[model samples]
Target: MKKRNTCLICLQGLSGSGKTTVANFLASTLNIPVYHSDVERKKLFGLSPTENSSLANLDIYTKEATIRTFQKLYELAFEELSAQQSVLVDAAFLRHHERLRMQQLARDTGALFLIVKCQAGQQIMIDRIRTRQHLGNDPSEASEDLIHKQKQWQEALTSDELQTCIKVFTEEKNWQETLLQRIYRYIS
Candidate 1:
């Protein structure tokens, strides 16, 4: 039997879009390690959720910090990939450039690049965010303002990007079935 090459599955979406949940499920089903960008950022920078929210509201310096965080994430991800380990990366990844960088990294490493875009209705997303905030278990770094900004960012996603990526959906259909089908297809 041939061993499967490393796969870098990236979960991208707006706040409350269920990216983290899907990524976690997929990682468990696929038996791959998961790398959450927000968790890595917090670990590397000692950034608590409140501090991350504050940074997101900032204008200039935050961009520098974000870049540094992404660089470290890429470094860690590459190290894992080098060991031929499958990994799932859970991140909002709202920037086109960041996505392109990951694609390049995938090509350079000869790893499979799977982009999973999670989507949901705006109202549903808002409700989920509110519930998460109330429960105080949301690991996302987004605040209310950040969530609003993310919705705006998602609205502007290009159709071309959507077409290229796999969408294991959560909108109108049964999320569990859709996710299961996607995992089945990926592993087979």
Candidate 2:
């Protein structure tokens, strides 16, 4: 029997870099399940995705919370992978360690692992954050300050990680379709 093609697609980048958008696009196009960190983080705390953690006196973005959130994401992804299904994860993945853990999960499950790093111009990122904040509907509570901080601390992919990685510049027209094609070609 031929083995099924399954993968853990990690959509990663700094906040406001269009990771969520790309994840959604890929999820729909590929008909795969998507697990978003922000939504999962809030769910872990018994809060709605758009609920402000600060307003509830809960800092879901704390170090411990982040660890729990990633663990939850990994577990969720593992379930899908173990079931022979492809899964997409949307997260900042700001640290190399985070990516490493996910990579190990993929390896353990015998699923292909691919990293899609979504990017936009700095100004566009700032503008997108502002617009999302103004609308107040996104699960992500990333502020302009948060994005700047992420820029300072976000780790670049190592050589090995780069081998399985693709960069998406989201500001261009038809980016989703282009990226979809690229992902299909890469996986094939």
Candidate 3:
């Protein structure tokens, strides 16, 4: 069998947009590993992926902490991509520069890179947030307030970045097959 070049798939979106759901789906269906920044963040505090709300490290959401978290994840991504394993990064990626750096990492590593931009209607996202919080067993730590804050500050993707992104409407459909086939194109 011929070896195909690996891909680095970034699942980027705001909280409650179904990034993790899609990431998990793709990883299971395609046999790829999904690296979630939220889970990793919690691990930094010696917590489990689904710690209680009271245990939430609200103060760790600062700018410096955000940068460090993404940086650490990106380094791990680079290593996995270099080893020829297609990997998924599930994160909000609120910063355009952070997304850019990952794109450049793929370019430098000779790995195919694609951004799966998850989006849903505002009300849907809000509802999902409430549902996830109510359930309290998911890895995400976003509150309704943080969702609003993200809406205020989330940097829209640049035109250049959009060129490499495949938008997934979480409210509408399960897009795993389309995403899988697209990534295959990069490998082929």
User: Local distance difference test, per candidate?
Assistant: 0.72, 0.90, 0.82
* Estimated TM-score for each candidate: 0.82, 0.96, 0.90
- Worst lDDT window (10 residues) for model 2? 1-10
Judge candidate 2 at residue 44 and give its lDDT. Answer: 95
List the candidate 1 regions with Cα displacement exceeding 4 Å: 47-61, 151-164, 171-173
Collision pairs in model 1: none
- Full ranking by lDDT: 2, 3, 1
Candidate 3, residues 1-188, lDDT tens digits: the string is 02567778898988888899999988887788788998887776667889853556356667777877898889889888888777889999878888989999989988777889998888889899899889988878788787788888789989888878888887775467676676566556
Which candidate, 2 or 3, has the higher TM-score?
Answer: 2
Worst 10 residues of 1 by lDDT: 52-61
What global local distance difference test value does model 2 have?
Answer: 0.90
Clashes of each: 0, 0, 0
Model 3: how far residue 62 lies from native, Å = 1.9
Count clashing residue pairs in model 3. 0
lDDT of 3: 0.82
Task: Please report how far candidate 2 places residue 42 from its true position, in Å.
Answer: 0.5
Error of 3 at 31 (Å): 1.2
